[model samples]
Target: MHIGKPHEATTRICQASAETVEVRGRDLCRDLMGRLSFTEYFCLLLTGREPTDNQRCFLDLLLIAIAEHGMMPTVQAARMTLAADPDSLQGALAAGLLGCGPVLVGTSERCGKLLVEAQSRLAAGDDAKVVALQMLQDIRKTGGKLPGFGHPVHRPTDPRAERILELADARGVSGPHIAMARNFRAAAAEVWGKPLVMNVSMPIAAVLLDLDFPVATIKAVPLLARTGGLLAHLAEEQQNPIGFTMAAHAEAAVTYKNTDEGGG
Candidate 1:
């Protein structure tokens, strides 16, 4: 079945000439007088609220941090969707976003919520480090990895996390959320018995919480920013004469043994 046939058409937006500098029905553009940062555009689109200088800076840092990772699932999907000759750029982007679903690009917001939970446990007179440790242990008991701490591609420290933290501290972002990050870091260190820095999501989570965005909004904000790259890849892929084709492939398959089987 052609699952993504409609996505290509969805990305096509009407362009206006210099003589006709206005486009109607795109409310998000109303706030952009000119030369707005990606953060500003993202905030405008997601919240319909222009941010203060501080909020803008914070959001900008986050968006810049996760802006693109070449050949990631999202980008690959965008290229592949275009290869399929979808109807529009929007359709390619939609297909890309579908690939990003929960397994790939959906953890930033969950990490934000986890930071809040870690803080609440601290405020209730529990040691933040201990609380974080216990939480990690609980997740392990349930067969889950601790979120927001490690990444396959970014080891030791997520460079984006490092960059955003630098910006966040320079802007004087302080309070329990910051404290929670610090405490969580210590706990992760103890658990790993070595230094384990926060990944991109953690710093963004801290910054968003500091800016008073509900933790639930963290993932939404990043996803919104990501659509830009998604669209760009889609458009670029369209130039290929062959249209969208699988850019790469793997030939290996895994062997599995059933645990619930009787000798037959």
Candidate 2:
């Protein structure tokens, strides 16, 4: 039985033969192993080109900013997975990474898409504010939550979002996407009749887009960053071992009330 087209079996990402390993057209060991920072190598691998200084700096900053957030579900999942299978680091990492979804680390991609759409409208000669307002209205009408606009803990504003915008302004990378994000913030307030906190996801998306990073790969930023965080958690879990404690706490916190009082 044959699978995909014969051409589909190949990968453009990397190639390894006995004598050499090539990645994105560069000899990985000779050209990149010692010289490029992991962050730079990540950019090279994703983009098939080296990042500009600004891109490297912003990417590093965004990664650090989003990397750790104290006991998020992903971390908990990783820690618990490690506790259950102390021998498998890869399994623990996979357990955490698997949790990256629309409600978590994946929001960056959605927010990037949102900004990209808004930019398209602006390029088509739509007023920025009008586009933002219409977007909020359309989202609300469709009963969809506005991506990157609110957070459970950060009220009124998200400090991470503010800091990202500040750095982008200082570095001169605050381009149209960033401006549109701000416009959308104001428009969201007007449309909702209440201020919505622009979360880190929005700034992350805006900054990456401003840096010309592809929307399709925006989620990779958070995933990569959070992997670092998960590793950290796993390291601590190895030494301190809180995964079972967390599981026990969770079990204790939920009261399994029987809906059918006497039926059981």
Tell me, by lDDT, which candidate is best: 2
Backbone clashes, each candidate: 13, 0
Q: Write model 2 residue lDDT over 1-264, tens digit each, in one string.
A: 777666645677899999999999999999999999999999999988899999999999999999999899999999999999999999999999999999997998999999999989988999999999999899988999899988999987899999999999998999999999999899889988999999999999999999999999799999999999999999999999999999999999998878788656
Top-TM-score candidate index: 2
lDDT of 1 by residue, 1-264 (tens): 777556645422335665543322343246355667767765655565667888887776666567677768778766766676567677678877777554566777777778888877777898776887888767767887666777778777788888777767787875577667777787777766787767877777788888877776788767876787776666667665323334533213444567677443
Relative to the true structure, candidate 2 reaches a TM of 0.95
TM-score per candidate? 0.75, 0.95
Clash pairs detected, candidate 2: none
In model 2, what lDDT does residue 216 have?
A: 90
Q: Which portions of model 1 show Cα errors greater than 4 Å? A: 1-38, 41-45, 240-248, 251-264
Error in Å for residue 172 of model 2: 0.8
